[model samples]
Target: MVEPAEFRSYYGRPILKEPAWKQPDVPLYLFLGGAAGASASIAALADVTGRPELARAGRLVASGGSIASVAALIHDLGKPTRFLHMLRVLKPTSPLSVGSWILSPFSGLAAVAAASELSGILPGAGRLAGAAAGLLGPAMCTYTAVLLSDTATPSWHEAYGTLPILFAGSALTSGAGAALLLVPSVETGPVVRAGLIGAAAELAAARHAETGLGLASEPYRTGRAGKLLKAARALTAAGAGLSLVARRNRAAGAAAGVAYLAAGLCTRFGVYAAGVESARDPKYVVVPQRERLRR
Candidate 1:
């Protein structure tokens, strides 16, 4: 029997083009966008339920996160004009274009809602804006994942089916963390419950992706990416466990919130690192293509 063929590229160079997106900035934008989207939803629900403090916290976090996300994206693009130029057209097939539209409107609405909530002006309009932002929250949370998956990155493309769900879960958890840190324990019942659910969903989706991605999952299980993802899993699990006790202890609640937020950050960075690593390895590209051709 003939031996299996060894995958190699000319001069040992990577066959796939690595992503040019700046590090830390892109991942930070992902985290902030997710947090902003989910926080908008939390703010709307809290306002409807008459939880004024929670609503205020959620509104502030949502607005702040959105602004930060914009700054990060613009920074990644190297200038403000580049980001603005993306808004010139609406392309249904382009994740970047669609994401820009979603992000722009959501940022404005979130800022408006937060401003009104803070200044106690135009409460009616603020409520409407907050509700509108909430309506767009889910799309905002998952659009980044779609953008990443739309690329040629092997690990990211292979996990596209589960990436959006993982991102949504992470977003919800991050939003809940912000609320828990700002609002008192007495008014954080919903936030705690949401965080628990988000943590569980994120963990589940990540596991499913790792197991189902086959060879593409290697990046997620090795090197810097592996370390970050492991930390994320541990922190998320610990935070979820702490959430049970957070209902009674403010300190525990704060710790849990921090843990959740940190975990979400780690997850985004881990995913980014994994994609970059995958692109730098010719084996990840060649082996997969060869397998497809063999079938």
Candidate 2:
């Protein structure tokens, strides 16, 4: 039997430097972005469909996520005021800069839409805002993947193709969670359908990314990140499976919604952790490049 080839590194030291991001802040920000983006989409749909109550709930969720996302950003920056500097210019080549721009507009629109419902000021304006947010929301949801993929990390860069799809799916799932949790159960048809679609997409995207990555995918298969991702997949799948029945059962809807929300959070944290591991492991960085050069 042939033995697998062994790889070596200098003192087993990391080939690349780890990312300069902290826990809770970055991960939570990712979760909030997904939830916010998805909520914006749902809000727009609700508004267009004359579902006033659903629109209000979705707007509230979008605004809440926006607030949380900014708070996490401020926390990560070590100062609540430092985030102002990021608004200086729009850089096309930098995902971080682009994302910052996308977020400001999306957040502003979402908040306006939510507040308009209570204030009764320019109600039609709220609809327009929701429409704008709906257009921009998907970008807000997926740009983080671009930020991560553009980095020097091997696994993230290698999985760039699927990361956006995965994130978009997670965003939709989280949006559905917000609706199921906040909206009336009798009006959850749209949310349930969105959840099912997101669930299917996330599972397929994640599996596709893992299967195609070769040695670089090791970070996804080992350690805490791996375990978290596994749980995420399972939870997502289970929740998706329950969505059909959930349409008729409020209790089931609650359970499935919570599961989807948890799965979304887990997927974000897992991806961040896997990216960290990939950056910290010399084997991941060198082996892939070596193979590429050999070909």
Candidate 3:
């Protein structure tokens, strides 16, 4: 019987360069950005539906999350100018450049709308700005997934088909969670429904990504990544169930919201950890290449 060849790197060096994205910074940005984007959309919908309190909460979360996300991204880049430099020209082909454009304008618009909502100034313009931000919300939410998948990271690139779906679901749940926590139970009908749906979608997509990734999925199911993902799953499951009774109990809604947010954060960090592992291990790189060649 023929034996499968073992893959090894020269002098134990990794065959691929691991991503330079720092812990907490990149993952935090991912979570906050996704939440901000989805929050903006929720705010806009709330405004249209005449839910002023929910709209107010959504706008505030969107603005706060956007500013924080920008801060994290700038920190990761080592300088604000490095982030600014990307805005020199629009590049449809580059996910980074496109994301920069989307993030910049979305942040400004969300901030403006939030300010208007809070200070009762320029209500007309605030509505317009909120609507515009909402228009850009979805792209803002999923663009980061594109940016990650565009890289050479093995796990991220291989899961490209589902990463965006996963991100969208995460974003929706995070946004809904924030709203559920801040808004009162009387005005939380839409938010509760959204949270439940987002939780379901996030859980389903994550499971699908793990199963479909084959060997590349190993990092997601073992070690630190495994622990985070396991926590995320549990949190999401619990939160979804709790959200069903949220309409009757405000405390339950708030607790479920916290769970969803924590789950989303864990998912982002877990994905980052898995990608780093995939790049660091030569086996992840070589085995995939070998299998591809054989096919």
TM-score per candidate, chains pooled:
0.97, 0.95, 0.97
Please give the lDDT score at residue 32 for candidate 2.
Answer: 96
142-237, model 2: which lDDT tens digit per residue?
A: 998888898988889999898999999998999998788777777788888999999889988888766778977778867988898899999998
lDDT of 3 by residue, 46-97 (tens): 9999999988988899999999999999999999999999899999999999
lDDT of each: 0.92, 0.86, 0.91
lDDT for position 170 in model 1: 95
Q: After aligning candidate 1 to the native by TM-score, how far in Å is the CA of 100 from where it should be?
A: 0.4
Using lDDT as the measure, name the better of candidate 1 and candidate 2: 1
Candidate 1: what lDDT? Answer: 0.92
The parts of candidate 2 lying over 4 Å away from their true place are 1-13
Q: Cα RMSD to native, each candidate?
A: 1.4, 1.9, 1.2
lDDT of 1 by residue, 1-295 (tens): 9998777789887788899999889999999999999999998899999898998888889899999999999999998999999999999999999999999999999999999998999999998999999999999889999999999999999999989999999999999888878898999999989998899899998887667788999898789998998899998998888888887999999999999999999999999999999999888888888789999
Q: Model 1: how far is 186 from its true place, Å?
A: 1.1
Model 1, residue 216: displacement in angstroms? 0.3
Ranking by TM-score: 3, 1, 2
Error of 1 at 257 (Å): 0.3
* Residue pairs of candidate 1 with colliding backbone atoms: none
Q: Give the TM-score of candidate 1.
A: 0.97
